[model samples]
Target: MLWETPFGHYYGDNRENNGNYFANDISNFYEELIKKCNFRIGEGFYVNILKNYLSILKEDSEYLYYFKIKPLISILECEQYLKLSPNKEVRDLYLECLNECSSLYNKYMNVAR
Candidate 1:
């Protein structure tokens, strides 16, 4: 499920029993899996999850940018507000993800245009 928070939009698995946010059957499946991992790995997992989607949907740059890539970037931007104190490993991963996302924005935004 996708929620519009004060921070930004976020994806969820509808654990709250409100409803599931499925754009389509298969796409939602992949999104749900990525979201679960993101939560488990404490948000820093966004890098690996973004990579997974890139590989899995090799020809779908637009989808990756709009769904996985953009949302993850927005989430990271809200880190200061979230006030999360991640371990060293997670912090490193988050930094790497930020760097990669910057490159990805350049690469994918052109495709989107």
Candidate 2:
């Protein structure tokens, strides 16, 4: 099952009823699990979740910024956001695309400013 939040979605097998954990905490737990176990399940699950999220966001004006510009700000604000990821190589490629989006946003903002 999945729980939706302002940040993202959280998932668990049978523990889906546990409403105690915050979304970030759940994400961190999975990240740590992947790091420790090199578990394909955790990584694959999160990747699928993220892809689904991006697809949904792509159709929404409010959230398209997240899949587009905000992820770059996330990296520039904290490289560890993706640099410390277990899937660092894939995340790095995502960061590159985010950087390009960031640049375009900057240019757009400058013109508007």
Candidate 3:
């Protein structure tokens, strides 16, 4: 299973550890989604997935708090994609992810570092 976040999608060995998957799955998912769907659908679906994962993380701070650095990596990757994506919607979605990832990165950097 994968937990999608504004920054990117996270895949785990199982639902119990999805947060652990972090950047790997998210990067792959973003790449594939961009290729497979139109800009509007792809962007909308990606954002929706991210929102769902954020909600889940909010419910269990302990589980996700430890993995804050992952969002930073995801965000950096998303920013790169934003520059390359031709679709406006997809680019916007990547921008959003970059913003969220930066926020999360800052929030957790003190502790994680």
Top-TM-score candidate index = 3
- Would you give me the overall lDDT of model 1? 0.52
lDDT by residue (tens digit), candidate 2, 17-59: 5555565566886677546434432545645644543444344
Collision count of model 1: 0
Cα-based RMSD of the predictions, in order?
13.4, 12.2, 14.4
Task: Give Cα-based local distance difference scores for all models.
Answer: 0.52, 0.51, 0.55
Candidate 3 at 98: error in angstroms? 0.9
Q: Can you write out model 1's per-residue Cα lDDT over 3-106, one digit (the tens) per residue?
A: 55333346576655433332344455556555554475664554576455335334344535546656657766554212233444545555555666666676
Q: How do the candidates rank by lDDT, highest first?
A: 3, 1, 2
Clashing pairs in 2: none
- Best candidate according to lDDT: 3
Estimate TM-scores for all models. 0.35, 0.33, 0.37
- In candidate 1 the C-alpha lDDT for residue 17 amounts to 44
Off by over 4 Å in 1: 1-68, 80-86, 109-113
